[model samples]
Each structure stands twice: as C-alpha cells, then as structure tokens.
Target: MADTLVAHHPLEFVVSELSAASGSAVTLTPEPFLPQHIVRLPAGSATAAVAAQLQLPTAANTWSRTADGRAIWLGPDEWLLVGSESTDAAASAARERELLDLVQTVGGAVTDVSAQRLGIRLGGPKARTVLAKGCSIDLHPKHFGIGTAVQTVLGQAGVVLLALPPGADGHPEYLVLVRSSFAGYLATWLLDAALEFTSSSSAAR
Candidate 1:
C-alpha cells in the first residue's frame, strides 16, 4: 500500500503552463522534494565537534557544497542542509535519524523540513531582473555572487534565496526556497511579470 502512494510536485498544476508561457529570457523549473533539514547549534558549544563530522559553511550568508549536500549558513547558530532531490522516504528517514543522532551528541538539533518548502530553480539573462521586480535585496554579481545564500523576502513571501553559478546563457541562476502554500502565488506572479519581456508567450496561470 505504501508503494502505491504517489508524490506530487507542489506546483504540478502550474509548472507546465508556466514553462510554456514564460518569457524567452527566463526559465523556471520546480525542484520538487529536495531533502531539507534545519540545523541549530547552540552558542559556542560543540561547533568543533560538529565541524569534524560534517563540512559546513561557518560564515554568515554563505553556503558550500558538502559530501552529502549543500550546507547553508543561516545564522551564527543556525544552518540549512539542502540535499539533492530525492523521493525515497526510507532513505530520507534514515538520513534524518543519522543527523538527529549527530546533533544530539553535540547538543544541537536537526529538524526535517523537507515538506515545509518548495524549491524553484530560476535562471537565464533576465533571472535577476525578474527577481528584482519582487525582491528588494541587491542581486548584482558584485554583491550576491555564486554560492551566496540569504534569507530574504521575495514578492511578500519569505524565502531562502541562493545565487548559484551562471548558466550556459552566461547569466546568473538562482534557487528560491519558499513555503509550499505560497509557491503557486510566487510562480504565477513571476510569470505574469515576465509576460512583458516575452509578449509572444501565452498567459500564465
């Protein structure tokens, strides 16, 4: 019976239409079901022990790829572990348990938050421009270069935004992690704003 269950993308209803109707200068793809965990380390405690176990970005507003996934620094005492896309529930559960054990040993905590948010991969020449319409933070390369991660507000939605490497189009790419409830709204709003840039495309849902 468990095997009969199906996993659906949060934006399943709108992604296809959004992709077909999006502007030429922008590409939006849903990175559904990425394994995400919230890591909290108490102040000045076991930071060294934790570092010995996992590779993490200790600096504020930055992230680094680890052997497992990307570890993003959320605050001096908080981090976000974002793993590759996976649908294996058993494997994810095992991972959560492993992390929980690790954190418990070091007096920290790990919270499995995979289902709490959705990841939207946004890229292309107008990617930053499109984001600028809704995001107040400066996304210029000089400021928010590759590997930068920050928690910010995008179009009224609270998000953990990451600036990834440039795409083949020679422009920046980005990953936006927003609450699942607001994903549809953000996707629709993005496509609507991008309509002016690509008049030939159809209307966004």
Candidate 2:
C-alpha cells in the first residue's frame, strides 16, 4: 500500500496547490442542450433584448468571439445568451419563455448546475507528460491547440477540458474543469502519479 503521509520532497517540478476555500463541494450534471451553437441574423434588433449576448465565432475548430460580440456558437446550433452573473435568472427565463411563445416549440433547456464542478489549472514543462498518464486524448499542442474545449473521461471522471492561451512565462498549461465532488479524488490521483517524476527531480538535484 502507498504511504499516504509521505514527506514532501524538493523537486525540479514545483507543485502548486489550488483549492477552493469553501469546504463544501459542488456537483455538476451536464445539462445537454439541443442546437449547441447559436447563429444570429445580422438584421435582428439588438436593443430589444434585456440581456447581453456574446457571439462566438468558430475558426480552426475552436470557439471564439469578436469585439462587440454578435452571436455565440457554444456547440453547433446552440448559443448561450451571455449575461452578467448579477442578472436575474427570471429575466432569462422570461426570454426563453418568449422564444418558446414565438416558435411554440422547445428550442433548448437551461439547467442550473452552479453547485457542481470545480475549475483547476495545471501547467509546466512536464505537464503534458503528467497528463498523458490518465487522459486518452492527444494533449500535444500540435494536435490540441488553444481555444479547444473537449469533454472526455479522465481518471474515471467526466471532465470538461479546455486549452487556454499559452503562458507568458513560456510554460505549457491546461485548464481542467471537473465535478467538484470528484475534484479531491482526481487531484490526489494526479499528484500520486506525479510523485515518481517529482521524486526523480529531487534525486537529480
């Protein structure tokens, strides 16, 4: 059995700990929506709507939005109507109701899952190698470029993976969004697997 209380070792790869202060964990359930991306007709009146929306443009198979955003394509035909966190959900709900009233059809459903999911960031020269131990996806920059968001299985947990802008410090970093309930489990697994590499760095010192 692996010793859980192994003393920390000095190593080349620094371990930065990130944790949410709230001891309470979050549970995230995927609220699948139909018509993933949203396309806006250029002629539509923008002021008639109560909330702000961001238009994400797709380029090179990545999600992006321009300055003065017009429409956002979250997936294929579904686009999230972006709004401030302070904005009332009732207003958005009203908007959804209005859309339904106009079309008299179910367009998309919004589910509240704020309690679930924890966001984490990991990056370093050895980051890619460390991540490869559990993830099946090719994490190489050549294959998984920046701005990419992928949902895949990682360490027996469903994870929402996103590639962010490169580090200005010239290091590689990947953004990991995992269910808060599984956050501790996944973190322990990752750190445990990294022990050898972490220990090796100390041995080299």
Evaluated with TM-score, which candidate comes out highest?
1
Model 2 scores worst on lDDT over the 10 consecutive residues at 20-29
lDDT at residue 140 of model 1 (Cα atoms) = 93
lDDT on C-alpha atoms for all candidate structures: 0.83, 0.48
lDDT string, candidate 1, 52-90, tens digits: 467878778998888877888889888888887575777
User: Measured by TM-score, how close is model 2 to the native structure?
Assistant: 0.55
RMSD of 1: 2.8
**Candidate 2 stretches greater than 4 Å from native:** 1-53, 57-61, 65-108, 199-205
The prediction achieving the highest lDDT against the true structure is 1
- 144-202: candidate 2 lDDT, tens digit per residue: 87767666777887876766675655666676656766766777666655554554334
- Cα deviation of 19 in candidate 2 (Å)? 8.7
